[model samples]
Target: MSTDKGQYFNDLRTIQANLPTEYSRTFGQMIVHYYLHLIKSSHTQKANAKGLKQQAAGILQEFKRKQSLRKDYPATDLLVWVAESNHLPQALPVTSLLKEKKYRVTYISNKQQLLANPALEGYNKIQVVLPKRGIIAEKQVKEFEAVVSSIIANTNLAIITAEDIDTISKAFREYVTYTRQLQADYEKVITNVNPKAALIGYDIPTEGRTLTDVLNAKSIPTFMIQHGAMAKVDGIFGTHISKTIFVYGEVSKQVLKDSGTKADIKITGAPYLDELMKKLHTAGSKAQGKLKVLVAFSGPGHLTTENHHKKSIEAVMEVAKNHSGSVEFYFKLHPKDNRSYYTAEMEGKNLTNVHFKLPHSQSNDIFDWALFADIMLTGASTVAIEAMLCRKPVISLDLTGDYKELSFVKEGAVKLISDKAELNTVIEQAVLQNFDAFDASSRKAELYAKQFYGPTDGQAAQRCAQLIEPSLN
Candidate 1:
């Protein structure tokens, strides 16, 4: 299982480094194709070449089917692009609210999860733009090669291997063909839809960048909505091509300003958080018992190595062991993490009080977990902010000093602990006493919410709708 996971992650890194970021989803599909080929090759006792050809043919057929479904539609007032199902919630509220005002809103995504989202059913249209698999024409291929060669010759990427170059070349060829096809399809849709403005969840990824580039070329206004907490201001939101960016709070807006980002910034808060706050306001408190400590695992991006994950889990288990029967630890896994990896790591040692929870299930929503947790612990997850919004004390473990600059620590929203001793002390204090009962911590939590997430009122969606209304008109 570890070998399988390692190979899988290595493939992911290769694809991520070589292909356009938007193709990350397509890379998963490619992995499925490869696995199918491997299984067939093993069953037939034959060379894998035949299976590879079969997989390619199958991908081509599906690509052609998706392409055949493309057709012209009437003009729309607004076009919203969402990359994943998780982004659907942020897009839904604004689109739904806009629909009431009679604006024609259309949604587009390459991900099936988003296309199948029930929340997007009320939109004017929902289109899925699947990536195509095939070689481009010889002339276009030559032109692409020449362009890449020039870039390689002049760029400072001095340590790339021949294998890396070959991988990048192949990936770039696919990206070029796929993006051109997408551009053609999107151009037709935009021309027929004739949307005055387009709204995207975030504009840093390759998909958003490519789509935004297309829309900007046609002089259509574009807006990027804040989908999550911004650890820093110099990323996608800061340097995106969108004319306007809708953030969740003044803090994010000010961060952009300090970073010298050239875009109109608006604080609409977060629609999902607004709704969660409403539920939290009415929901009953957790039943009193052993103090529940929730530890949120940062995703693969931050926990880059298995050792990092192992060490983090070890730290939490140590705390749980120290507290024994007095406190319980709930380990919340990141959505993108493989559950088996953590489960295998914790199979022995018998930490009886430690429990694992998956992300985004009925019982494990960050907000729900926050409500049940007396104190939340994490390295640098957005859950720190969510926990604070739920009135839970947050202990940010910065053992490696990676989280020192994060907004939660920098803004005094959480208790930052850099050493094991400090972590133990903080956890003991949190478990023994009502940490939220302290006036200073309560005030700090409130300030964190205000600075990080503008308002708790359930009008964030309406506010976003109002911002897009003028663009539609």
Candidate 2:
């Protein structure tokens, strides 16, 4: 292995050491062990290093072969970059609507699995290749090195430790290096596709940000589609990358405005949730007998702490003890959360009525869960808004006492509970189907839905398509 590889491994070790205990225990430990083994084996045996290189080459060759099989379609007026499978639903509708307007469309994605998406059937699908490490040139290397150095020098040592600084520098170096490599490929694709306009969903870290930069350099008008709730701390939204941003509602538009974003903002609701919300509204109120509560669990990390998880379980168990056979609890785990961690956490707890629902796929319809649930509970998840869209009462378990400023709580979309006593009272009211008893009214939920999600009349896709069409000309 090269000296740079060894240094990278050392940096990973430094990062692993400084990571929070919960993160290190759950996920970061595996990454640390993988790099440790790779570095150790490379030093021990040259053959092992050769074998690892061969394995990577084999993976790359297979990827190229699959990409070669994709049929090339003529350049289109619009190019839609699908970053994640979750974004496909939002992108697909806009692309489909564009096709109806006689505009040719091409779809590109880094994840090959998305090519099989039924929604992407009629569109052209192209697989994106992320540049491998060590492919960056020396000139680019110096440029990125300077950028990393400046970042490190500017960082406050009081708040960030030397180890943290080193780890971040190393990570950013890799990001810049890979991004430079991917930029060349993206430039080539854009030149070949020659789209008059491009569409992307959210520009933050990784591929989306890099792609936005490339599109801006090429003078292509790129529109950013809102994917989810925008927080105040999400500084990436304020960057002047895309030409325009299509947000879900006026609230999101204002958030970007307050953040001093340079892009033009338009309210188009949520394209992906539009149809789902329409269907849910048409289905009317579900027949209720027993109290059905849906608990949306946040992924383990800064969003939800171990203490929050423990206390949430304790509070829910207490509520269950009182209601017993009259109520049922459905615990929905976040896509990134480990099912085993939640299962182990609930072990030995005598709660027969509580059931766990693990995320099966990116296409899993959470709206169905919202439809049946009379009330939803979560710590700080976007699903609270989804539940409110379905007219279901939302209860935020603020056991950690840190989520006082969450958008749902601030907007009165959810009832915040900080203790077992509050949890019991909220659950009791929810069970009786009299959430208004606790001052959590249906009118508040309705207003929140409108302000947060705009009009969910199944026309957001059309609005987005219309917004992108004029830019193409």
- lDDT at residue 299 of model 1 (Cα atoms): 51
lDDT (Cα, tens digit) per residue for candidate 2, span 404-443: 6556677666788888887888777767776664365455
Task: Quantify all predictions' global Cα lDDT against the true fold.
Answer: 0.66, 0.66
Q: Which residue pairs in candidate 2 collide? A: none
The window of 10 residues in a row where model 1 has the poorest summed lDDT is: 1-10
lDDT of 2 at 461: 89
**How do all models score by TM-score?**
0.77, 0.78
Which one is best on TM-score?
A: 2
Cα deviation at 252, candidate 2, in Å, is 0.7
Q: How far is candidate 2 from the true structure (C-alpha RMSD, Å)?
A: 8.8
lDDT tens digits, residues 134-249, model 1? Answer: 46676755654554455445444423333344444455444555555656666666777789899986665556666776788898999888756675543333345678888888
Model 1: how far is 124 from its true place, Å? 3.3
